[model samples]
Target chain A: MEPAVKKGPADILYDEVWELARTIVDARKQIGALRPSKLKTKNVSAALLEMDEIVKATEEASNTIMDSAEIMSSADASDAGYSALVQENCSKIFEACVFQDLTGQRISKVMTTLELVDTHLQDLQDLLGPEFDEPDDGVDEREGDEALLNGPALTDEAISQDDIDALFD
Target chain B: MTANKKDMSILIVDDYKTMLRIIRNLLNEVGFKNIDEAIDGVTALDSLRSKKYDLIISDWNMEPMTGLELLKTVRADATLTKLPFIMVTAESKTENVVAAKQAGVNNYIVKPFNAATLRSKLTSVIGEF
Candidate 1:
């Protein structure tokens, strides 16, 4: 505006550097919106947990149904026709019980996806520094019912029936 | 000689109603009709005190008192010390088995078991059905 002064290469470079810096700050602010604290209360984890509970509930129900069906199939051997019908229906129930197995596998896949999400969120939190870390709520992760009911260990720490029998021996 | 298979008094303990029903049904099918049930170790203990049972088949996981705890309590009691107690559980951890053995459990059976397996364990503990 004064006398049409021509900007030098250094001044032009400084303006360009500041513009790039402003853009980076804007990007950082956008990323900061994705707080790691949300992972605790987010539906993603809660939904996955619900899916796990569904698998367990379905397994229990399926077991009950299958057990009942087995009992019925074995009942009234004298009534050949009725017994045959029961045997056939029981077969169907047993076949239908596979749904629980399939559903369990499917939920397992979803749980894997949830794990991936958790891993990525963890990575993001790491990148964001300890300032984004959540405070400890002082909750102990209990297994089940006061007792250490860790229901069928998946690790190599689990033993076999033979091993258990050996203990009595 | 062993007592009649059907005459043997047995008690099955578990917190799950479905599991109790399944075990009861299986025991009935196997001709052990003289069977009682309790929902947890505490209930089983009360039942044990009030009635006489030749065998105790219990789940290891339960509220207030676990089967392991019950086994320890039974071993501590003078009359129940000699009682045949079998701990039935899905937990097949070696440490858990060691604990049960240390607690003086007569036998252990893993879950997802069949009537035949249950019968075999029962027979092993209470002298052949």
Candidate 2:
């Protein structure tokens, strides 16, 4: 307040640099917010694991029914009624395997999200332009495999098994 | 050129371990015994080079290489060109099917398939079970 100090180019440059630093800090916060939540991924992973166990259990149950049917059929031919019941139960177990399809679809969606996040992070990294080291050449590690990177289709968009079968005809 | 399903050496390629297990189980249900597995297309190509496989069942969405890429490579190779390759994928796009068909995939199976569908597809490709 004693005297008015005229800002020089150096001072202006310093302020500009400080503003850029602040902008970077803000960008970091924004990125942190934009990043895919680890909690969501963890939750999905846990659910998928549970689904897998359930699917395995169903498969095991179906196998047991088949084995039991085989043993009963070999041991005695008069147990047709019991065999029919077992077959019906096996069919139900097989139907339960549909969970695999649904879960697979869901998991694929999550994977797509993760992949998108990865791409964003990569893009951000490129924008930052190597704060510590030389800039990366922007080559994909799996560049040769890029052509094959088609992830799973969304459930609604996926072709039905019947449709695929029709191709054979 | 049908091979015995039980005796045929098959390679199952997929990025998902669960999928690999599911396919192995399904193949087992259909009487395929000599089955081996690869986690992705790279390993699949290596396996194919090392030893002969009667059939290949591969998932499309894989890293470092996809089932479609593997199919293209297989078709490009003189020795492996005629190998009976089946693509199993969750993708149902007509374009995807067209691409696979253009690449010379022996058969295609959409995901959420059961043993019956798999069996039928196998029959279609390898002929009569």
Candidate 3:
């Protein structure tokens, strides 16, 4: 067989760069121009705010239920106007149950955020490819968490603020 | 001017608008009307500097600057150190509570609380409403 041509360091570096560019092009095709800042501010923050609302709704509803139960328990039904008391408390319960509707809507918003994040993550996976797994080799999990603190990324491969928080956390 | 607790202006800080609204309503139930709002610690700090407040009720997990950081900053400042602060948290974690207490938080309120709990926490800090 003919002697094979040896590649220099410069040639090897060019090949690696070309490979990265190809991977990015492919990922861009998959993600269709991901606006990372939007993901952090609008998507993530909105989802979190929505989830907060859900928590508030849940807590308010439970509190209402408990308050009514306690009121009903403390007051005797045998006493005059007991039926009126029960009617008022039951009406409050009906009002509190409306929280379910708000919670459902908030959950839907969170789901949408998760789905979008998954798609963005798919972009990252594609760009990183199989080589992403190699970095974990011989790395302690706790050390890996520290290693993840790759500060503000370059504009070409920017991570959202939430992504940085995830890395730090 | 006499500093009446009921009429004293209060500053409420929470990143979430709904939480601010809930706290505002509860504070109303507690019979305090002059209230202001801040979205995060930075804004709250600014408000503290520009205007005087009787008490501060701040949520723990705010962005940019957390409530713990805010507390530390407040305590560090001789002017703001004496400001009565009641922290609000969704978590009942001992470590967090210890940290807040160490940072000089006057009191803390766990989430899902009602008017009574709010009033109770408020009472401990600023005296009975």
Candidate 4:
């Protein structure tokens, strides 16, 4: 009888792929809870669009997982076969997870921003009666009722000016 | 400006703080003393736009921006396009490599990988070892 092949890069790649599949499944469930609150805004249309892109990316990543499993189970499991390619391929998929995580965070922050914007708009509607003439400078800092919304303002935070200038030049 | 131990930074973009910590520790173990973290792609893009990184190690399954989008964006940028990028993902499909290669990935690594695999990926991708 042939000796059992030792666990090599293919096995490593397979286990990694399986673990990632599990992570994706878990993330999908977690994201379902977040989708509703994120979609609840007009200003968040951009963020919502971003969310769509992320979801698609996640799906695409999930799809690739099947290939990982296939390659492992096939003749490719041997080091003499497609193990090198599998290792390389696995890294790329792993890379996608990095971006997915980023997208999720961006969505969360944007959702928070959207909520704040909604609260501010409501206060402005109540204060100026919703028909105030547009201020020439359009910079109104009206303090409203007891509904104190606390968080970082999006405008106040951004990449620095030096960085911008460097990128442009 | 001179590059110090603190200046040779690596940016890790992933939504999971736990994963971020894992990667950071691995990079530290691999002699990369300086590191930055981004929770998602948009923020990562912002960071990439703002500073020059020695390396970018990212996850593939984030929301609002996946690693591929970030890679595409990074590749689209003329100045920052050449920066070395390594994708650390759980997805191991063949199409993933095709897309990532098309998007200009430097190297890819699968998750649950050890310190050796991480180091090897970085070395193979950037040849900075």
How do the predictions measure up, each by TM-score? Answer: 0.73, 0.55, 0.51, 0.43
Native contact recovery (fnat) for each candidate is 0.74, 0.54, 0.00, 0.00
Model 3, residue pairs in steric clash: none
Worst 10 residues of 4 chain B by lDDT: B1-10
Ranking by TM-score: 1, 2, 3, 4
Candidate 4 runs further than 4 Å off: A1-169, B1-7
Q: Write the per-residue lDDT of candidate 4 for residues A1-169, one digit (tens) a residue.
A: 9998888999989999999999878766754545545555554677677778777766666556544544454534556747677776678668756766877787787778677667755554554453664546854465431111222224444323233223323
| Fnat of model 1, as a fraction | 0.74
Error of 1 at A160 (Å): 1.4
Candidate 4 displacement at residue B103 in angstroms: 0.9
lDDT of each: 0.79, 0.77, 0.77, 0.68
For the candidates in turn, chain A alone yields TM-scores of: 0.53, 0.45, 0.62, 0.41
Report the poorest 10 consecutive residues by lDDT, candidate 3 chain B.
Answer: B90-99
Of models 1 and 2, which has the larger TM-score? 1
Best by lDDT: 1
